[model samples]
Target chain A: MRLENVWLRYHRRGPWVLQGIDVRIGPGEVAIVLGRNGVGKSTLLQVAAGVLRPGRGRVTDRPARVGWVPERFPADQPFTVTRYLTGMARVAGLGRAAADEAVTSWTDRLGLAAFRSVRLPELSKGTAQKVGLAQALLRPPGLLVLDEPWEGLDAATRELVPELIAEVLAVDGSVLVSDHRGETVRLPAARRWLVADGSLSEETSSTDETIAVVEVAVPAARVAGTVARLRAEGHQVLRVRSDASTAVSQALPVEPPRSAGAARPAEPPLGMAGELTAEQPEAADDAVESAAGETR
Target chain B: MSALVRMRLAGFLRTGRALAPLLAGLITLGTLYGGGRAQPAEAYGVSAVVLFPVLAWQTKILLDVEPDVQRRLAQVTVGVARERSAGLLAAAVAALVTVAVALLFPWLVGGVSGPVDPGDRSIPVGLALGLWAHLLVVPAAVALGALASRASVGGAGYGVAVLALGGVGAVVFGLTGSVAPWLAPPIMAAARTTAGDAAALTLLGLSGWALAWSAAVVGGYLWRRRAQG
Candidate 1:
């Protein structure tokens, strides 16, 4: 699916929220939509889902079998979670038995079997989100548009989300999602797009392309070896420090930790000590547990 | 055409959920002392008949059940603009329920009350069709009341309240309280009129208005679907 020169505004508004935005998600490709809040990230997702239309431009190649889950869902009915998913599947034109079977499979996969009888309003946020994603995936829609699919999930389930996306792509389905958290995963690896300043910019990168600039300070004699190792590992390595670190020197600057199931290292980046990552098994676990306690 | 229309009919039949309460309410209404000797135009039973039908139309979409239905309805293929099936089904349910309530309820009530004559059968039919036709306004009201869905503490309570309000309005307008019935629909006005009466203009006006309402709502659905952020 693709949108070209798309412009949109709401209810006698002055300027458009989206201006001349252009994008395309090829079949079987996973495109990660990135943007700040109110930067039209949700709107962009809605347009692709056919919830909203481009005001002055054209949207083409949108497959009819598209599945979408909006950010704020309606939870006002007496429908049980299973009943809800089956209903949607039937509405999407599946036979009743097929719809029921599909719902059963997805609910089991998403770990929602325990909550199947619960009404939508009673489920916790994460559980409700699982139902949302499950409904969209119930019938294996050709195109899946998700708004923050992994938001509010616990660690283990968050790890499973990218796997779910990967599985979808493996079947030749397209996946488009918006996630503020930086996530890295293995399949169909994704191209990123930034929705900003009333427009969308394709921030392109791929698995084969170099992305990181790793500056290293080793013994002058070992610098060449360090650079070679980094290059062989597919890193965009840069040499910032020519001399080795002394006893008092710090190895690298620290940044905020990525969410669990994301790509942040298990231990601190090579030298920050136990407080950072849980790298060396036992001691690392203790430090992580302590950090989690401090957070609480 | 058959698939869409047939689905619409079967979906409309599922609207029977609304009848559960309506039948229960009828039992209570039967026990209550009705305005027994009042003119046919002043019947309170008129409103009671249509209440459940409207309620049924509002809640049957199953969108309220799974996967964030309201957003899906308004923003996805399940909603009216994305597909005609839901909208047509909604309308058919409303119309059928209206006819059933207007004709059947009055006939049932009159039989129980021991009326000698059929007591203005034409008028009740007109009133029912008119009211049923008016129900086309419902989906727009529901879409507008998107916020109410949250405020109702769930959805069941709000659905009941909305049905009551619509039913009450229909009954109140039926009172031959004056030419006021003329403003409601041709059916109600024609009920009290003699054959070839001058009030025939009211029927034409109401039918035109009803048709216009249908066009307006469908048109709005299309526009809202096409509109962007």
Candidate 2:
């Protein structure tokens, strides 16, 4: 999808929030929009998602299906978790049985099954954010646009955010997201688009060698073994924090860490890291411990 | 589109925003029929006149039922055009329900007696004419409601003003009988025709005028929405 020469302003006479913004993202690609608050990052995401029409120019080659999750989910409505997700699934063109199946699957996958009958207005911010993600994922979207998706998420769900993006990318769907928090650390390979002065500039470097603070989540029982394994493999072990959530995140650099005097160690084996992503709630049975360490 | 309409109607009812206009409509219907039985044509004509503004109010409430963020999500799910069309269709459906209640309320209250002064038309014919008159005014009221929606006017106070002016304007301008009666819906003409022994040709002309006015108002709403986007 491409936004060609797009310019937008909320009001006709208002100052432009986006100007001459031409950008493109192909299938199986991810673009992370970076900007401070009130700098048009959300506007660019909305334009990409086909939610807002550009006053001048147009978004061409947009996919027919777009999943748009706003910064804050509008949970003030009179709908329960199940009802809202089912309604959204149907709105996205799913059949009755398919809609029900999708709702059930997403609610379970997002750890929202317990709140199925709970009204939206009664959900906490993080839980409501989970609902937002569930609705967007009900049907595999051609383009998924998320604005500040990690704002109110719990640590475990925050780790799930990268996995969700990877799932969409795995389907050859283009993903566009705005992240002001350093949550993009997990998305080391995503291309960066900086929004400033109502214009967008692409950061073309995909090979930046910098020290990345990786957050790895593992089952509490395996926390000691995982940290020992990571340290023995020449990766630096950082602080460990335990939480009631079950799942560990691995925060490591996309490229090798740069140190002037020290000999560079071989890249850590990703086989075990991938396995850590699975939610072994029975293993944790109590808490998921996250040892967010950086390899120096 | 069907899903969007269903979602909208469900949201509107669940929010309980339907209560105010519903109460207003029920009160209007009770007042119109409380005195006792009357000719179906005249009673329906008066009901249509009173129901116009109430329907307009109901439509506005339904249109504004969903929050803005959810509306944007719907736009993404089923393109902007379909989402907007769904909103209008839902409003029309709500108006249809209100019309049904208005049509049946008189009968439920024992408000019908016989034919008009000419004493020639059947009960079914009067009821069909009543339904026709209500349906004719629905599209026009929906347009006015769309014009007064939060998307169109922004502020609640301004929205209310627009709705009141549009509803009153349709009646007042239509009553003038000469200068630009076509500018507004032929609501007064409909009431007059339904109340009296009017010819089929005159009723057809009223239908034409009402539809034309609705089309014009809906056109304006579309223009406003496009510009806003």
Candidate 3:
């Protein structure tokens, strides 16, 4: 899929959010979009997903089955989780039996078994996000565009996201994801597309060995297990601190983490951590828990 | 196309928005059946006029309840033409049900038996004309509702507008006797009972007018959607 010189604004008189932007993603390639809030990341993704039309230029080679998960799923709908998923599956051209099976499998896989019968409005943010993910993955979309896929997910499901992306990639489906958190580290060899000032710049990963700094925080009790898991995932645990302050300082090889040894890490200990330099201070606690609480 | 229509019908039924029109139709049917014993043509004319408000309100509800995201999805899948047709079909079905139930009321109450005007035709013929008139008006009302909604008119506004238009048409028909048949659908339908030689011509003219009006409304709606996009 390709966006050629696309320009967009919310209204005719509104300032342009995207100006003369051109980007492309080939089949089976995953592109991780990086940008701060309100930098047209969602708009770009929406344009790519065919949800929004650009004012100028055009998108070409868009696949027939394009699955897009917006930043905030509209959960004000009247259908229950299973019913909604089944309806979406049917819309995606699945037969009744197949739609039912897909709904059941996705609900179970996303740990949404208990809430299958619950109405969407009654679901928590995290559970609703899971439902959003399930609906997007219900059909094997040729192009999958996701905005903030991991924002409200639980730790286990957050870890499961990479596997979902991998599954789409394995089937040669292109994936585009926007993230505020540094969760793109979990993706298997993704091209980085940085969105700044309405224009996108592609950044290819360096082949030479380099060092990556990551912060991890866990309860002092599970420090040993967390360290072991980090090392098993091929990150060198440069330092480990044991305090009510949950801070993890590490220096790792820049190569993509080995998927074979990337087991679910141990659950984190209670108490909040100081903000990591790369992450927002307000979101530090949630980020620490997300990064640490990945035990299967 | 059938699946799309079925989906629309199912959604309308599940949401229970069809009940408002059904209730109004029942009331109108009861009133018309009670009054038609004396003058069948007038009863059918009044009933046809009553359809304006009932169908306009119902169509507005249908348009409001249609999910925007689902419509876009359908555009990518089954195409927009089929989606639009399905929506129109669903609204037409609701209008048909309402008018059909009203038409059955006269039969249920032991038929239209009374002293008929010298110029008036048979009860069966009047009822048939009423049915045909409804067949035309229902879709026209649905299309008008679509256009009104695109103009940001609420259901109440649409209802009032239809009532006012019908009232003005009735006044013009009353003032200009010979032109009544061409000016208003209810007048044209009511005239069907009394005019023996020109009945076929009147039916052909009303059908043509209805078709033209419906086409214009649907065309306007499509143009608006394209322009907005």
Question: Highest TM-score: which candidate?
Answer: 2
Off by over 4 Å in 3: A206-296, B28-42, B73-79, B105-119, B150-198
TM-score for chain B in model 2: 0.95
Ranking by TM-score: 2, 3, 1
Tens-place lDDT digits, model 2, residues B124-151: 8788878888988899999999988887
lDDT of 3: 0.68
Q: How much is the lDDT of residue A109 in candidate 1? A: 82
Clashing pairs in 2: A214-A251, A215-A249, A215-A251, A216-A249, A216-A250, A217-A248, A217-A249, A218-A248
TM-score for all models, in order of appearance: 0.63, 0.85, 0.74
Candidate 2's DockQ: 0.62
- Which of the two, 1 or 2, has more TM-score? 2
**DockQ in order:** 0.21, 0.62, 0.20
Candidate 3 docking band: incorrect
lDDT of 2 by residue, A1-296 (tens): 99999999999789999999999999999999997789999999998988889999999999888888899999988899999999999999999999999999888888899999999999999999999998898999889998999887876788788899999999999999898665675687899999999999998774433344444445556767776675555444434556423223222223234333322223332222312221121232122233232322
Q: Which of candidates 1 and 3 is the stronger one according to TM-score? A: 3
Q: After superposition, which runs of candidate 1 have C-alpha atoms over 4 Å from their true positions?
A: A184-188, A206-296, B1-33, B37-69, B73-88, B91-95, B98-102, B106-188, B193-209, B217-229
A19-126, model 1: which lDDT tens digit per residue?
998888888898888777789988888888877767878889887778886675555455679877776777777787898899988888888899999987798888
